[model samples]
Target: MRSSISDRLSKMDKRLLNVRFKKSTASIFVLFIIFIIVFFFHPFNELTTVNLQSYPNLVDSLKGNTVISDIKIKKCFYYSSCQLNKVEQLQWRRLDSPLELYAAKPFRSLSRSMDIFNTFVFVKQASAQTVDSALVDVKITLKGEPINDSNEGWVSTDYDSYTIWKKFISKSHETFEQVDLVRDLDILFGMDDLQDSREYWQYQRTSIPVNAPVLPHLTLLKVPLTSHNKIFTEFHEFQSLKQNEVLLAKSNSLKIVQISDLHIGPDTGFCLDSSIDCTADLKSLEFLESSFEGESSSKPIDLVVITGDLIDSHRTKEFKSSILKSLSPILSKKIPFIFTFGEMDEVPLYEDKPEDENSPDESDLKVDTILKLNILNFISSLPYCYNKFVRYNQNLHGLTNYNMKVFKMPVNEETQLKLDEPAAIITVLDSENHKIDSSQINFLYRENQPLKSKDPFKLLFFHYPLPNYRPQGEFKLIGAYNDKKPLKKKTDMKFRDDIASLGYQVVSVGHEYKNDLCLLSEKIDRNTVINSMWLCYSSGAGASVGTSVDYDRKLRVFQIDFEKKQMLSWKRSALKGAFDHQMIHEY
Candidate 1:
């Protein structure tokens, strides 16, 4: 009877456990169904739709309803069922275009060939905006095209025959009436290149080519012809130097930093001779900024003279960019600065050729002149550039030939005195060809006639050292002279004698990278005592050029004291992080 009762109770407990499992399973199933219903029919979706409805134009744009198609077609045809293989075969049979023929047998220098071809297209477009837009479109269209290897499809005549470009423009026009093709290359490429058809647009300030060896197809851009189009201008506005005619200083002394042989390239350049890995351009800039920071508060840097070689030769195509990069540190400091042209400043890096052979295109004088003019226009347009555009002689051999007056502050700080006479004069000349021409020398004398009466302390700056600049008898040399031989032009003594006669006391130059010698020598005329001049060479500040690992990159600093009529100079080394071997001379 006891066993029968226990079995009945156990069966009743099992029934109760089964009922609880069924209830929990049914509850979870109901919750899952409710979650699905809430997720699909959420109020957040309706709120998003309501917000988009308020901006109809935005909704249209998001749905690809713009003037130009957001979806670019690889190849468009009038007929929907047009066979691509048939059209490609027809294009292959077409005669080779000028561009295709040029690409087949490009110039020795691939970069030069690309530059010429792109320039031709730019000229044909005749509008800066159109050219820019078209180039970008071409780059996009030929995105996967091989740069090193030739693609037969791109080398066909039909590729650049305006068939595709015309079709694109027609399609764009059909959709939108606001879009139109216009010619306007005046701002960047210059209208003069169009007017003077004899000269090609070699120095047009455009970006480098994306693809080389294979010529890119020409594409007509569907630009919006509206008043909303803002003309693209340079980042910095043109700053005149008239206000800075007289250099001002904190105290009685004027400090000038001479940085030379920057050899700045397109981007952060590679170190040519450095043992450690570094970016040449960045290191040079850091050295300059560090030197500026290490300056004495009482004698701050008042003037900066970048002697020359601001840009590297092999990469002269992007000289505008390179120059801006080189001068960034100086420009940031807001110090008044001047520039002189080096031999490599305007010359492009040409491929190796036989000494006796000559290529007409590579050695074209017109192209060279255009490049120099373009470089000058760019540099002169920058802010705080003390380069004056006024040329004493129209036929002056070089572009950067100008003079600046450095005035002395009154001893009494309380009294505002109007001083008429200048304490010193700084003359900057261009020795781009490694020699100063007779025309430049004559212009120098002509421009100095008025200021000659002031009898100011005259200092001259150029790129190349003059022949036999060192004194024969006795001279004091300061700093290292590690250069195998000073890179001087084999010119007559006329230039040296002329400047010496003009009361020039110091002739500072930059070209030899390894030499930083400052020699004070007497300038005697026919056994008679005359003024003593300082012939100084500032070492190369750029690491891209050949530099000694033992010697640190440096900048030559000049501090002129008007009261004492004295000038103190020293080398500010990058490794040393301070001034070294300070030398002083009284005028």
Candidate 2:
């Protein structure tokens, strides 16, 4: 009448129900182990996000701002941080040990701009390669915003921002995309010797942008997202400070004195009279230096600009050494050296005396001359025939008769007489403009005879004159060649017109020792450009000044006053004596 003993036993076990629970638990344990393996060794997983659509909509406010307080980062989704306003219990993220953070109130700017409290922490995380929990041993600062600075040059901020973005990716194989926000800046905050390429503010422009109305206090937390969005930002308390601004200054009516061609040598009175046996040459320099020092006027010397030709010649090493020593007196002053190359400062391409075949011996040339000769020979080899002919001229013998009489005068003279005319120079273009004619130097500003007075101070310096001069003074003693035949081709029409067109008030020249300033004028149709100063001064310190030249000539010194727009000139005895007589001329 009964089924079996085994069947009854099975039925009894099922009724207990505890036996059924054991089998179900064992199956779940197996599945849990499989899940643990997938989580630890998987390459990358679908992003995990806690969807919370109930948060306050602050997207509109965050359109421009980098950090929006309305969205608080929680477990996974952004929460309604707006409702948590006021001193309400706040969630502050701790960065490290030395730093602290807090969120308090809203900040307001004078421009009526409003922004939530934004805080930053100045932490010395020496190894900021990767973010970690323990390295969070830093602090979030309450104040201390980074000041803006100019960038020296450009650099690559690509790798630097890549460091902060690396922690977000889930898989090791995934590479982070370059963020343009950080790519533009150069991350040169610490290292030196970067030269032009450098960035002053470290992470300010990128991650921790100062967008909102600067809050006072803030906290820096390392709480990261699930290896997808590695965001590192600040949690801050809002406090206000009366913001300040900066101002700048200006300078007006800046005046300066430009003095050039001040060939101050030891021999001020080297070339004077053959009969009088007196000294006077370069007499202007002594008075010029003292005049600048004596000027007790307002704005005496804001700046002393010197174009060039300040020295006679530092040709010999010994001569150069002496000059450097003497120059200390002037250079030690506060005057700035605004200088450029002059025809004399640098050595001449051609020799003062071309080598002569009449030399006592062929090897009489110095080692320097020999080296220069080699260079000349090599240059002659070029295909251009110009340099070959130049080389031929350079190698010519008795190149010039320096001892030849440049002038011839009567045996005796009483009144002031013409001593000697200037050397007949064949003008060559200066080093600046190579193509300038070498045969003609007619750029002198004095074409219109001679003049009496000039309104403004004008000066002209060059290597030649517009026309040949008749011999002057007594040259019988020195014995030199007189003026050569007039220029083969009539005076240059182009250069003559150019000089006459210049509206100069005064012009100072050094090449001629005519000791005169001719008031010149050119008839330009109905109008006339004339009466400008045509100053041809006398200075040949290292040479003789002929038979009848004066020992006490006009050592002219022109002074200018920009305030009143005036000019005062004087002449001295080259001995820094009272300008003896000052011609007070003003404009």
Candidate with best TM-score: 1
| Model 2 poorest 10 in a row by lDDT | 238-247
Q: Give the Cα error of residue 285 in candidate 2, in Å.
A: 8.3
Whole-structure CA lDDT of model 2: 0.28
The count of residue-pair clashes in candidate 2 stands at: 37
Alpha-carbon lDDT, every model: 0.55, 0.28
TM-score of each: 0.56, 0.29
* True-vs-predicted CA distance for residue 121, candidate 1, Å: 14
Give candidate 1's TM-score.
0.56
* Candidate 1: tens digits of C-alpha lDDT, residues 340-396: 788778442233446475542423334455565556665664555676543122356
